[model samples]
Target: MYGSQLWNITSLKVRMVYTQWRKADRQVLSVSYMTNCDLLPLIAYNMPLESILDCKYISFYKFIATSANKFVSYTAKSKIFDYTSTLSKNMAHLMHKYELDIYEIVSLSKYKVKDHSYYK
Candidate 1:
């Protein structure tokens, strides 16, 4: 599958593909990798990067950490939806269960994609 198609899939599912891709590239070099530090950049570099910047979850965290004052001031002054806290919580939760099993990750993707009514 293509890079954009992968994004539409849940992160739980993509963990496996990312692992395989990593192993194939001989980049990860670790057996039980958790975070997608290597995977994200690899796919990003290989794929057609239409977006000027990758506005993924990690990028969001870096922005908040690197520009805490500016972010705080802007958020306090602006009327943007305050999903920062919620997103951070969710990211932390996902990080706790990080796995690099490809088959399991694909299963997760299928389950999430099939469960439209759960969110509804």
Candidate 2:
């Protein structure tokens, strides 16, 4: 996750990795195959990896937006607002799920609870 903000969150590799993570979580927690995904957070105390990654992307851009370098700030703001970009689409989905906007990303970043519980 050191530089994951630059990754395409919708890629096939990301999905496969997330699947592996879920399988590992299920095994580690001794959860039955029939167990509810929402209940995983209650049991394991962690958010889904992708969700955290999405948050990290937003946070990293927020950091970039603060840069004094004109080129850096320009690029960050450009990517963030580009409706045609994949990152923006993911951001929209995430924001819709959490009822958040660009300004609130930081607030969510400081979240104390490790669990996603679908982050509901």
Candidate 3:
């Protein structure tokens, strides 16, 4: 469903949480995507949201964004949860730290939705 495929995605959401065992904490998240077509990739992507954001336990670059255009707003059919618990007090006090809260991906659409759902 990446390129030039018709998708009837009605809604999408995620359910996830962190579990602490001993001194280390790990997160377990369940991802469920509802679409007319099978959504294996979508489900797989959502499952790692928590782990991707973990700096101490797991390290990876992460981005989150909404799909929006000049005339329309896109709701987040996907969600992400960071499950590494809070940063240490020493790291939190660092003055020369950087953080990025959002990122965007571009998609081109050949067709427009003219249904009442688009306005809603």
Q: Score residue 65 of candidate 3 by CA lDDT.
A: 28
**Candidate 2 error regions (>4 Å):** 83-86, 104-109, 112-118
Q: What is the C-alpha local distance difference test score of each model?
A: 0.37, 0.69, 0.21
Q: Would you give me the overall lDDT of model 3?
A: 0.21
Residue 99 in candidate 2 has what lDDT? 69
* Cα TM-score per model: 0.26, 0.71, 0.15
Model 2 Cα lDDT, one tens digit per residue, 1-120: 786765667778878988888888889999887777667767898777776776676666666777789998788667767888876766666667666676666444434222321445
Candidate 1, residue 102: Cα displacement in angstroms equals: 29
State residue 57's C-alpha deviation in candidate 3, in Å: 18
Candidate 2 overall lDDT versus native: 0.69
Tell how far residue 54 is off in model 1, in angstroms.
Answer: 14
Q: Rank the candidates by lDDT, best first.
A: 2, 1, 3
- How accurate locally is residue 16 in candidate 1, as Cα lDDT from 0 to 100? 65
Lowest-lDDT window of 10 residues in candidate 1?
Answer: 47-56
Against the true structure, what is every candidate's RMSD? 15.1, 3.2, 17.7
CA deviation > 4 Å runs, candidate 1: 1-10, 26-60, 66-86, 94-120
lDDT of model 2 at position 92 = 69
The regions of model 3 sitting more than 4 angstroms off are 1-16, 20-49, 52-98, 101-120
